[model samples]
Target: MMFDDLDATVKALFDDAAAPAELRAADISFDTPDRAYKPAQATVNLFLHEVCENRALRDEARVMTRSGDRYTSRLPALRVDCAYLATAWSAQAGGLKAAEEHRLLGLALRWLSRFPVVDERFLRGSLRTPPQPYPLSTTVAQTQEGRSNAEFWSALGVPPRPAFSVTVTMTVDPFDEADELAAARRLHLDSTVMPHAALAGRVLDHTLAPVQGAEVTVVETGARTASAMGGEFAVPGLAFGDYTLRVQPPGGPAEQLAVTYAADHQRLTVVLSQP
Candidate 1:
C-alpha cells in the first residue's frame, strides 16, 4: 500500500509541475537502473532508501478484538517511515553537464516543495479509501549526513549529485490476529447474605447399627444426600430457612422431620429406629 501511494504521489508531483508533454522533456522516472545512459532530455530519478518504524506515532499497547471479549494486545503496531532519494540528471547529447542538471534539480525541488504534505485528494488506490493517517506527510525531506554521498554514487557507478531525501510515516498491521472469529464468554458474580454452615446428621437402625445407604433429602428445596460411614449425612451451603428433612432408608418407609436452620447453628444427629 505504501509503495502504491509513493508511486502515485510522485506521478502527481510531475503533473503539477507542468503538462505531461512539457515534463516529459525532463524524463521523470521512479526507476534508477541505468546511470550511464545520458538521454537527450533532462532526467529525474527516485531511489528508495531507509525504512524504519515511526516511534512518534506509536499507539498504546492496548488493542480491541473484533469479538469484544475482555483482553488487551501485548504487542504494539509497526508504524514506519520510508525514505526515498530523488535526484536529477543532465540533458547533454554527449554525456553529462552540471549546468543542465542543476536546472532540472531546481525544478524537481520546486515541484516537490509544493507538496510538503501529499494532499489526501491527490491520494490514489487504497491510500484514498482508508487514507493514510491524515495528511500523508513529507516531513524528513533534506540532505542526509553520516554516509558519504560520493560512496553512494560510486556504488551506483555515477557521479554524486544533490538529491531530496524524503521520508513518509505509515502504520502497518503486525499481524492478522484479529481476523478469525472468537467465542465470547461472560462472567457472573453471585452475592451471598451470610456464610452457610454444613448441615450434618446421622441415621441408625433398631439394632443400634449405623445406616450407610440412607438418603437425607430436604423437602423445601428437594436437595438430597446419602448417608456416609457411621450413618453420617452432611449438606453444605444451605441458607437459613425451615426445611422438612426426610430420611428414606433403603427398603424401609420414609420418615420426616421439621428442621429450622440459622446462622452458627450446631450440628445434629438423627437416630432412626426400626420402621
Candidate 2:
C-alpha cells in the first residue's frame, strides 16, 4: 500500500507537463548496446553521489570508507563531484526528468514500480540513522520498529527495529444523541477519520482514549499517532487495512457517516448519532 501510494505519486508527477520531460522520454538509441547501458550506469552513479555527498553520508563514509589519501571531509566532496559529473552528462544528453528519474528509479524502484521486495529480513535491516539528531525540542519517536524505524535508521544505515502491530478497540452508541453531540463537540469529529482506523498500518497504543465497543467506527491519524503516548493507545506505522470498528451499543440504529480530510494534521471525532 505504501509503495502503491508512492508509485501513484511518482507517475502523477511524471505525467505532468512541467516535470522534466526527458525523464519520461523514450530512449530511441537503445539499438546501441553501449548507449543503452550508459544511461543506467549514469543514473546509478548520480544517485550514489547524492547519497555520498549528503552531510549525513559524509559522516558515515568517514567511518565506512577511510583511507590516508581520502580523509573523511573529502568524502562529501568526492561524492558531490561524482554526482555532478553524472548529472551534467545526463542533462546534456538525456534532459532533466531522464536525469531525475534515472536517479529516482535508481534509488527507489519500488516507488516507480509497484513491486517492492517484502522480506522480513530486509525490513529488519532497513533502519536509517541520521548524521545528527533532530533539534532537542523536536519530538523523536522512541520506538524503533516498522517503517518509521526503517526510515530513520536507513538514513543512518542502521538496522531497523523489530516490527509489531497494535490493535485499538473502541465502542460507541448511535442511539445516544446527547453523548454523540457531546463527543462531536469535544472531539471535533470530521471527515478525516480513516475508513476503519483500528486496522491502520502502524502501532498506535499511545494516543487513543479508550471507549467500550459501541456502534460508530473510530478513526484517527497524523501527529496524533506518534503523540498519543502516555494517556492513550497512540498507533504508529499503520499498514492499511479495514477495521471492524464497534459503533454504538447493539440497540441503536447506525447513522450515516461522512469523513473528510482537509489538511495533513486534521483531527477527527467518532459520533454514532445524527442530528
Among the numbered candidates, top TM-score falls to 1
Q: Each prediction's TM-score against the native?
A: 0.54, 0.16
What lDDT tens digits, residue by residue, belong to model 2 across residues 243-270?
3333343344544334433324233444
Clashing pairs in 1: none
List, residue by residue over 26-115, the lDDT tens digit for candidate 1.
Answer: 776666635655555577777765688777787776565553654433445577777777777765644447766766777666666766
Q: Which ten residues in a row have the lowest lDDT in candidate 2?
A: 132-141
Stretches off by above 4 angstroms in model 2 are: 26-275
Error of 1 at 137 (Å): 1.3
